[model samples]
Target: MRVLVAGATGVIGRQLCPALVAAGHDVVGLARSAPGADAGLAGVRIVVGDALDRSSIQRAVDEAAPDAVVNMLTAIPPEIDPKRLAEQFTLTNRLRTEGTRNLIAAAGGVERMIAQGLAYAYDPHGDGPANEDAPLWRKPPKPFVPVLAALRELEQSTRDAGGLVLRLGHVYGPGTIYAPDGSLLRQVRAGKMPLVSGGAATFSFSHTVDIASAVVAALDSDEAGVLNVVDDEPARMSEWLPFLARLIGAPQPKTAPAFLARLAVGSWGVAFMSQLRGADNTRAKNALDWKPRYASWRAGFATELGGLAAADAS
Candidate 1:
């Protein structure tokens, strides 16, 4: 099987490409820059193209001529210029909404397509762990309206195209927001990260490797539609934040009042930092026969932090 991975140099893509190759599939990695930009991608056939640019995307896909197309493109990170920040929603929305369009269009002969979505955007109904069938909140009270609206568009776009939408959990890995030396970790180490009042928000987190594996599984499966690609246990903030601090040997976060958190982090951040909602991956496991390699957040969290600690000691 020949596989085309757009955004092939992304955190998840970085792992997915190698996994696909190791599984005996020919892998083509598409990125915005030259092939050598990705360090561990030595043997991968790299094509340079910006997914936002439909022509470039089409050309890359046409050249790869893969049996399946994996749309892994997402633009988010340290590039925080005010203008870019303003376009953050637009850029990523286009990547999900429009970029997927171009990839599917270009994959004229491809059998399957795997696209990205967010599991957290589901309507926060009364719940311990929400499954794939849970209702999505297109408009929340205030701050979430715009964000959820964009997410809704992304999901709808993929659904309309009949592509597999993997509503990925919050990605934290080597090149992501929680990278060993990244902002979140730095905050924790510096004691800048504080726990919200109650600190009971449950977050469903998935390891980058697990996410990559799920993508690999999607390519070979006939099943399609939305699936939650997340860990078995979604840890509450009270549990995970302090646990993360302990793992990093950092000071435990100070418990701030929920009102203060709402004021400091805004209503949106407060909801995310203090709510309880976890996505269930039973559908993926049952249908695709895919169980996450990192079954629990405890395992994944330890792995990430342990790796970081080792790197620091070295």
Candidate 2:
């Protein structure tokens, strides 16, 4: 299969493009700038294109002439301030909504399509693990409402285009926030990442590699719908934060009262740490015949947790 991957130089995209090549698919990587040497896109072809520009996307798609197109466009920042979480995704929101529409329009003839979505946006009214059917948070902190709207637009349009939406969990792996040198790690090390109201919010995590594999499986399959691409264990902030701190030898996470936390991290941050829901991967597993390699974040973190210690020793 000839596959064109937008955002092909990004975190998951860097890994996904290589995986597609390894799977014997002809892969074309779409990036606004020339892919740097570190992109490691040895066997793949790179096309320069701006995702939000419909004409540019059309030109790239025309040049690549792919049988399938994988839309991985996002502009999430290196470090997210929970206080201004929605603001951080301003460009990402555009990419998800506008960029997605561009890709679908450009991919007029290509039938096989898959786009990245988020598994962490479910409404907090219900139980722990939300499935594809669960409604998105009906109302959120005012700023976050647009973020949800963009995703809803992305999902609806992708499905309408007969594409599969892989709603991923909190992405973590070598190059992500969980990475040793990443800003989130630094925040934890500095004792700035506090637990909100005992940190009851559930979090579903997805490793970069695991998310890539799920995409590959989705590309191989013929069906189209929503699937929560997460690991087997849906964990809570209370459970994972301390474990991570210990793993990195960071100071124990401090607990913040609801009102105080809201003052510090804003209503969104407080709710994120206290009321956000996790997602279930059962449907992705059964539908795509896919399962995450790191079935639990515990095992995944254990292997990669030493970077801080190693950095300290160095």
lDDT top scorer: 2
Off by over 4 Å in 1: 78-87, 141-143, 307-314
Clashing pairs in 2: none
Query: What C-alpha lDDT does candidate 1 achieve relative to the native structure?
Result: 0.77
**How far in Å is the alpha carbon of 148 misplaced in model 1?**
2.7
Q: Residue 15 of model 2: what lDDT?
A: 88
Error of 2 at 55 (Å): 1.2
Query: Across residues 61-109, which tens digit of lDDT does each residue of candidate 1 receive?
Result: 7788888878777777643322233345566766766677777777765
CA lDDT of every candidate: 0.77, 0.90
Clashes of each: 0, 0
lDDT per residue (tens digit) for residues 205-314 in model 2: 99999999998888889879889999999998999999999888888999889998888788888888898899999989999999889999998888778556666757
Displacement of residue 170 (Cα, Å) in model 2 is: 0.5
